[model samples]
Structure formats: C-alpha cells, structure tokens
Target: MARATVQDVAKTAGVSVGTVSRVLNGSAAVSASSKEKVTGAIRQLNYRPLASARDLRRDRTMRILALAKNLDSPIISEAFRGVGDAAALSGYVSLIAPTAGDLEREQQLVDILRNGSVDGLVMFSPTMPDDDIEALATQLSVVQVCEIADSEAAFGVSIDDRQAAFDITRHLIETGSRRLAMIGHRAARSGRLREEGFREATAKAALLPEQTLFADGDFDFHAGRRLTRELLKMDPLPDAVFCGSDTVAAGCVREITGAGFRVPEDIAVAGFDDSIQAEMCVPELTTIRQPAYEMGRLAFEALFERMTEPGASRRGRTFLPHELVVRDSTKGEAKA
Candidate 1:
C-alpha cells in the first residue's frame, strides 16, 4: 500500500539507494550493470518515482499547466478535458488557469504559470500577441488551441474555420438566399478566419458585394441578437444570415423572431459549431459541427508532444474537419 521508495528498489535490486537514484536521474556515472539491475527492479515492482525523485534526478518538478479562455465556455472546457486526459495517460497531472478570455489576464497568467508552477503550458484561445508567445516558448513548452495563430510560433490543433465558414455560406446561397449577411466576432483567430472564408466566398460569386453584409460582434448569443437586429434594420434585410459561430446565430434568431420575421420564410439564419445549445434553440439551429471532443483530445496531444520533446519544430497545423448540420432554423430539413 505504500509507495515504492528508493530504499525499497535498492533492497530488491541488490544495489545501494545512491545507485538507484543515479539510474533514475540518468547519470552516466552509474555502472551499466548497476543501472540494468535497478531498472529491472523498477519494472518488476512497478515502482513510480516520487515528485521528489524528479527533483533529484532531473533537478526539476513534474507538473503540467493548462490555460484556457474560460472553463465555462463549452468549447474551451472540452479543450481542457483533452489536455487533462492526455496528461493523465502520460503519467503527469495538469493544473488549469481559466483566463476568462482576457488578453491582459492571459499574458499575466502565462507569466505567472510558466514559472516553477508547471513545466509547460497548454494554452487555449489565447489573446496574447505573437511576440509574447514566441518569447514564452524559449523558456518552456507551449501548445495553443482554437485560435488560428502564427503556425510557425506554436503547435496548434483546431477545426478548419475558413472552410467551415465557406461551406456554410455557400449552402445558404444555394438554398434560395442570394442576399446574405454574416455576423461574427473579430477579436479572435477562429472568428476572423470564418469571416475571411465568408467574405472570400461571397466575392467569388460576384453577386453584389454589398449584398453580403458583414457585422463585427462577439461569439455570444447577445452578439448574434445585436447583429441580427442591425441587419433587419438595413434598408433591404438580408434574405439569409450566416453566423460566424452557432451562439451568435441563435441570438440573431431570437431578435429576428421578435421583429416579426419568420425564420427560413422571411429571413433564414444559420450558425456554426453545432454546440449542444444549437439543438436547444426553438428551431434547432442549422450550424457547423466543429468536433468539440476531438479538438480537446488533440490539443492535449499537441501539448504533450511539446512537453516531452521541446523545440520539436512543431509548426504543425492540425485541422479537424467540420460538418454542416441543417435543421428547422435553416430550411425545415428532412433530417431534423
């Protein structure tokens, strides 16, 4: 029931505790014969080195630090889950810092947590600048999530935002909506990328660039309501509204209804990231499925890679595919 100590390993391996310590710490001074015996004893006894052991062996502590925009956001929470699950599997534990989507707090927390608190960081949806992130990486491992950042700066795992938005916008155009409007948040990388995709697609169609209305807003339900209200007030309301993310679309839908406009009849509305709330909406939001669980799973995996193999040149852009889910909010689809 007790933790296997260095003394226990020494007794089992028939070597001195000092020799066992040397092998655990990867000291070359320990003879090969002694190292083999200690390692074999460790395997047979299933002995795990203590936190103190890492300090003795590597002159450091074993800990993982995870940062997210906020744990309350469903999207960010799932990302933390991925980091935690990966840490557990890798024989490490994670401490989370919920940044509440504040840039200053994100930077301050990064400075605070990147010290001895944790060996490395798994930052989700950070608003910290590129130079700040690049500077942090020199001191410790850093893996970022959700935001489409400088791929050369850090390891990132996220959904294909541009493509996701492009497809959804195209879908709206095909569904009898020529005059389209987009509601999005301009503060973060994902929102910006989706907005870029929307603008690019509309321009390619050459259907009156003015017809594609674009409004900047947060990715929340209120932003959606505000943007939708603005669009409705325009001289000519958009036939369909394409939301950057689902939360915004749902909000827009509420305002649309309040304004006496029928969804999919007078003004169809679509959203992104088919979060659970999407279905809870009155007409079951038509949205993009952003693979929340998978995104979380991979973000941690990327963080693990950064931790175990620092300076791995992990400029990897891992993009998970997204899906278009149509419901009553869009066109009274046969599927939902």
Candidate 2:
C-alpha cells in the first residue's frame, strides 16, 4: 500500500492543505471544528507523520504575496516592481494578487497566508479594516503599503499624504490661486488626509469657507469629469482645483478645456500621485510624486524583517518622502 500524503488526508478531512498542516504543526489559529475534522482524517487515513517531512513542512516558503486593488496603475506597478526587486535581493520571489475590492476574497488570501503558502504578505491599499489587519499581523508576517489603516500595531510604508497635499495646495496659493476647490474621494485614508491638508491650506490663506469648495467621488478620471461639471455649475467657479490623483486631474483638465477654459489661466489644476497621466496631459500636471517604488521596497523589507524575526517588536509604519512637481497645469507663469 502507498503511503498517504498530506493531500490525501486533506481530501479525506474536507479541509485545505494548509489547514491540515496547521493541525499537524499545532497552530492555534485553526478552528476547533476544523481541527477535530483534520485529526479524524489523519486517524482514518492511518497517516503517520515523519519527523523529517514535518521539519520540511515547517520550513519557510521564501515567497511573498502582494495584495493590491488593481495592478493597472503605473504608480501601483512601480511599487510592485520595487517589492519584486527588494524581495529578489533577499533570494525571495514576490507575487501580486488583486483583491478586486472584495472583502471575502481578501479574507481568503489571509487564510492562504496562514496556510504557509507565503513567508509574508504585503498589502497595498487594503480593503480590510485596521483591527482585522492588526490581528493578522500578530499571527503572520504582514506589512501595508500606501493607503494604510491607522494602527501602530500594523506595520506599513507610505508618504506623508497630508503634508504632500498641503505643499501642493500652498503652491497653488502662492501661484495666485485663491478661489479653491478639492475633488477627492472619502473612501481611502489617504484621500481624507489630503482633503484635511487642502482645507488647512485654504483656511490658513484666509479663504472664506464658501470660497473653499469640496466634492467627494472616486479617485478616477470619470469621477473627476463628473464632479468638475458640477463644480463649474456653481455661481462662481473655483480658480484652482486639487484632484485626489493624476487620473482624476486629467479628467478635470479635459472637462475644463472642453468648456473653453484654459488650464492655470482659467482654472489651475493639481493632482496627487505624479503618475504617467500627469505628463500625458497637454500642458502637463502639477502633482505630488509619491515614493511608490521605495515604499514597496521598504514594505517588503519590513515584512521580511518580521518573518525572519517573528519575536521582534513591531516596528510600526515608515513614512517615505513626497516631492511636489510644478507643471503648466498649476503654474501658468514662472513664480519668483
């Protein structure tokens, strides 16, 4: 008779291979019911665990799983590339998986991590809540990239979004833009921070509350166009608009130019994430250059550190630098 393998036991137990491994390794993360089921399967299959095989099962996979909402954005791809590069230096390969804005799918990925498929995980703009992520971090190696939840217990890497937004907003003010408005989404933590920074800059400039308009929508081109149309309908249009992202800013530019308004001269536009779309604009875009690649690299390093030293204290989050790039969209003329 052939020896029963882990897969055979998993099939008989009606559980995942990881779950069976967890049962064999005595991981407490496994559910009571599932543990019982795995044990029953082990006995039924008459599976005898070999000491050497168990040790091999306990070894690291040296693989990292990167979870993102999507990989289409240049900024996101750049960040993932950074992760891959950094992981490569440590003799580990990185793989990306899109969450597609599905919470259930996100949880499944977490389960896969628990199953020991990957040595660690790095999340980009995760949809999971802070508490859930924090809990996961306690049991598994995890790190967050941009758009992280606010939690000291959870390690992450991101630029100072509020400061970046403030710098851009102040630049617009310095370049003689007063009647300001911001088009941002409230779904992400970064958006809210940028909005707060925008508000701060406007209030400090002594712009009246009514002078500082606001619109909430998705961080995309269509949302920018739709929101800009509504903003333009106001009695007095804003002279300057700060979009949440370069994609959104492109939409804003298209709509404003389509309405016979010249950028900067008629309606100055600014955006976050100095993505390729920023340069693709006719007059170019003024935006914040988030250190996405560096953040990605640092995110993996952080996760790797934890994976190698599971008992080490949490290093918390790291804030990378952001640069303000002045372009024709916001700077109509050279400012002294």
Candidate 3:
C-alpha cells in the first residue's frame, strides 16, 4: 500500500501546496473556506499534522516546555527522553529547561513559561509553590512528576516509595542483616518515602529500629562519599547500609571496598532507582526499580490528552508500581 504525501493532500483539497501547508499549520489568518477544505482533505487522506507546521500557526504555539532539576542525573535524562519520544509521535515540540537545583533560576523559568510562551508544561521535581502551580494551570496544561506531595495539586505520576522502600529493607532483613542503617536524601519526596518504607519494614520484622547512622547527601557522589566516611567512623559500624539512590550506593560501595570491607560479607548495600550504573559496579547494587522511563511516557501522554481535550479528567491519579531488584550487593543473609 502506498502512503499519502503532502502533494497528494494539496491536490485533493484543490489548493496549492503552500495553502495546504498553512492550513495544516493552523494559521489563524487562513480563510474559513480554505481552512475547511484543507481540514476535510486531511481527514479524507488520513494526513497527520507536521510538528514543524506549529511554527506557522498563530492561534497556537504548539510548543511544550519541560522544566526539571538534576539534569546531570542519568535517571532524569532517560525519563525526559521517554517523554520526548512520546511527544514526537503526536507532533509536539518540547523545550527542555534544566534548573540544576537553583531555586531562583527555577522560579525564573516558571515565570517565563507562564507568559503564554508554551502550550503545555511539565515540571519534574519543581520547588515552585502551590499557588504558582494553580495560577499557571489556569492558562496552560500542567503536570508534575516525582515531587508532588499534595493530591489537590496538578496531576502527577508517582511510585509508592514508602512501600517499595519497606519491601527492600525487609528483604535485607530477611536475608539476616541485623545492624541496619540508612543513608537518605532530605530534598526529594522519593527519598523521604524510601526512608519511611525502610523504617516500616524494619519495624515489621521486629528488629531493632534502625537509626540513620549515615544520611545520603543531596543526590551527589561527594555527599555520598562524605556520609560514608562519617558512617564508617561510627562505633559498631552497621552491617547493612540502605541508600536513598543508586548514585549514593555507588559512592558507598567505592568507599567500603577501598577501605577493605567486603560487600555482602562484612557490609551489604541496597539502593533505589535501578539505573544503568546498578550493573556497572563491581558488585552490582541491589536496588528498587521505579520505572522512570515508563513514568515519563505516561506523564507526557496524560499532559497531551489534557491539552487536546479540556475537561477530560483521569481516573483518581495514576501511580506506577515499583519492584525489588536483588543483586550481589545484598547477597548473603545475616544471623537474626
């Protein structure tokens, strides 16, 4: 079967290629008769909108802006890539705005986005206030991922951090680790959730309530290394260390191995976000799988739907499920 082409559409609509292009682009200045003819031809020929044509449209900018913190993180990079793939299929263009943890810079980006510069917006782990989000939603399609804590706020896609974290903690406990300590981050919801989950799991096992002997630094290797050094210095160092993120765990592993400590023998390490680095380590990190790419795809799909059809509500929020990934990091069981 032969596929349809722009010339075919133009010929069928009884208009020039330029006129058909203008109509496809949704140029506001296009005459009603000409627009109708082009639109009808589009339907008849099963023609698709050209993303580039968005530039020609006046009524709609057809541009989407995505703002995110932690651009350097591999997890963030892949998640946004998933969103971009989904957006491309629908003929949408996205402008990525990375804030890199600068609160003021993030706010500046939001302020700029609110001026009708883009048709849709996605904020990944934004530090913006609820009032600002509500105000922005009044004019544009808005969605959140990973950082949304309030249900009343804009639509979001998240995972059960508490539950997943608990499961992993318990798994380590069941493997016989008794003196457990956690290294967690304080800036993100996932970090908090993972902490709560680990605590709950430890509690369920009726083991000594684990204290955060070491806290993971704010999602960076330097922080992880610093905390690891501090934790190792503690009298009666923990046998098992749970990290809030895989990056932190990687740092912990490096320090532990270099210090002549054996993984899963003397000390076990578990982390969250099963990224590529999970397997790259000498002893792969046993972590939780949050399906970052999947979450990103679903988020953009939801955002696109909202933009094209107003008043269409999604079923009581969607939370993608999580999984426990067991690896050599926590390879052995401890005495109860």
Candidate 4:
C-alpha cells in the first residue's frame, strides 16, 4: 500500500489541504473542531510530517537567534527567559549570542546566523547603527527590544525610556533633592534617552547648570563606584544621584555608605531597570520597572508572526509600560 499523502489526510478529514496545512503548522487561526478533525484524520491515515519534506515545502528551520550586549546582566537573563519560554511553546528553539557591543563581532555573528541557521532574530539593546540594523532587517525578520532602531524597517519592543527617566527624576526632585547627578553609559541609545530625561526634569526644576552634574561610564558596578566618588568630590556635592542601571546604583549605595553618608538622609539615590539588585541593596533602590520579560516575549511573538505570514502587516513598534518604584533609597525629608 502507498503511504498516505496530505491530500489523503485532507480527504479523510473533509477539509481543504490548506486547512490541514494550517493545522499541521500550528497556526492559531484553525478552530478547535477543525483541528480535532484534522488530527484525527492524520492519525487514522498514519500520515507523518517528514522533516525534510516539511523544510522543502515551508523553507523554515524552526529556530530563532537572540542577541544581547551582555548575558551577565540580570535584565538580559530575565528577558531571555521570556524568549525561551515563548519559543518552546511555538515548537521552536532559541539560540543566544552575546555581542558585547563590539560591532565587528556583531557583524560576524549576523553573517553566520543569517546563513539559514535561524528563521528570525531578536536583539536586546543593540548598539549597532540604524543603517546596519535596517540592512539586516531587509535580509531577514528582525525584532529589537530595549534600544530600538531609529528606522521603521525593523520591528521593536520597548518601554518609553525617556518618559520613565523623566518621571523618576521628577520623583526625586519632588522629594526635595535639589542638586542632582546622573551616572550612565554614553554608548547606548537607552542610556542617552535616560540622560535626556534626567536633564529635562532637572532643567524644569530650575537646577543650576553646575548643580546638574553628569558622569558617563559602562553602566556597571565599577563605573557606578568610580563616578560616585567623583560626584562626592564636587563642592556642595549632589544631594541625589540617578544611575542608568540597578547594578550601578548598588555600587553607588556601597560607596556612599562607606563614605559615612546615610542614604536618603545625606545623598538620596535612584536607579533604572528595577532589577534584583534594586531590592537587594542595603536601603533598597528606588528605580524604574521596565517590562523586560514581556518585551522579550513580545519580540519573539512579533517575529514569529512575520515568519509565518510574510505578507502580513508588520508591527513596527511595540511600547510596553514602565513604573517608578519608590524605595528607601530615595524616600526621606530633604537634608539641610
């Protein structure tokens, strides 16, 4: 007897071949009743979806690539968790790569992954230029999270970093912090947006140009510690400091307390990306809660949607919500 084909299964199921194809491909558009019938027919006919046959027909690898600047960061870990979970549910596997903000390494990895190894790509806080990102998107489905591309050619999922920064900075100001300082990475677009927010808020509060201090670093603990030491040296040191990341804020907290100053009493502190460090710090950090997990999950979903339906309208940008989390680090009476 000849092996049953998809047509045979469709005939047995009393549905069109397209309907059976959609069901076999895990498309959610198929109704539960139709799916039941198709599955039953497939079982009855003893039909099997051979890997080579499916790949030849669909031209898909059932794999995705996820790129990040650094996997050491808690934010990246959380986001990757979401990506992994979502990919598993969709019968796909995720491959993670760390570019470490090196453009050459990014190019090399992209070249390698673009060679039919992945069906799509998801990037977290990509530091590459918009033109480079746009060029990559033209070749394959790409979704960026956190730091988004400036062009409309690529899809993105992120929170309103500028607005979140503004809100957090305003919160510190309202809490009576006059002299404000900021520590962040100058290399990342997200960091720049955050700095912009801080500057905008301080300017609105009429802070002196001299009083609004600024420091740039790699958005890590060492940078936080080094910059905090510098900020402490200024004449009439800043009464409050905002860091671009929770890890940096934790470093600042350690330095400040080690210098014999009480947090929120001598110099208040605030951080972004309400990561685990925010809660684990000595006084706990007041920070912005970005939806990192959801951003990652949605990035994959958007990419997968484009992969399944190449002609479908693309969701160019998706902005998740952010919240300002008040904690002991930035809550207290104004110090005289």
Q: Highest lDDT among the candidates is held by which one?
A: 2
Cα lDDT of model 2 by residue, 1-336, tens digit: 966666688899998877887787777999999999999998998986533223433577868898888877677888998888767645577889998879999899878789988888888878988888888887778888887887676798899888998999999999898789999988888999999999999888999998899999988889999999999998789999999999999999999999999998889999889899999997799999988988887777677668775666355778888988888898645321
**How close to the true structure is residue 23 of candidate 2, measured as C-alpha lDDT?**
81
TM-score of each: 0.78, 0.80, 0.79, 0.82
For candidate 4, lDDT tens digit of each residue in 1-336? Answer: 855656688899999877887787778999999999999998999986533324433667788888888988888788888787666645678899999888888877777657877888888867678998888786678888888878576889888888999999999999898889999887888898998999999999898898798899977999999999998888898899999999999999999999999998899999999999998998989999988888887777678666775665365687899988888999653221
State how far residue 253 of model 1 sits from its true place (Å): 1.0
Ranking by TM-score: 4, 2, 3, 1
What lDDT score is found at residue 232 in candidate 1?
A: 84
Model 4: lDDT of residue 116: 77
Please give the range of 10 consecutive residues that has the lowest summed lDDT in model 3. 49-58
5: Cα error in model 3, Å: 24
Model 2 ranges with Cα > 4 A deviation:
1-58, 332-336
The best candidate by TM-score is 4
In model 1, which residue pairs have backbone atoms overlapping below 3 Å? 246-272
Judge candidate 3 against the unseen true structure and give its global Cα lDDT, from 0 to 1: 0.75
Question: Could you give candidate 1's per-residue lDDT for residues 1-336 as a string of tens digits?
Answer: 855655678999999866876687677999889988999999988897533334422744456777777665667766677666545544467788878878887777777555666667777777778777777765667777777567465777888898899888887877778899988878888888988989888887777877888999887888888778788889888889988777787788899999988988988889887787788887788888877766766666566556555554466578888888888887545345
lDDT minimum window of 10 residues, candidate 1? 50-59
Give the CA lDDT, 0 to 100, for residue 204 in model 4. 90
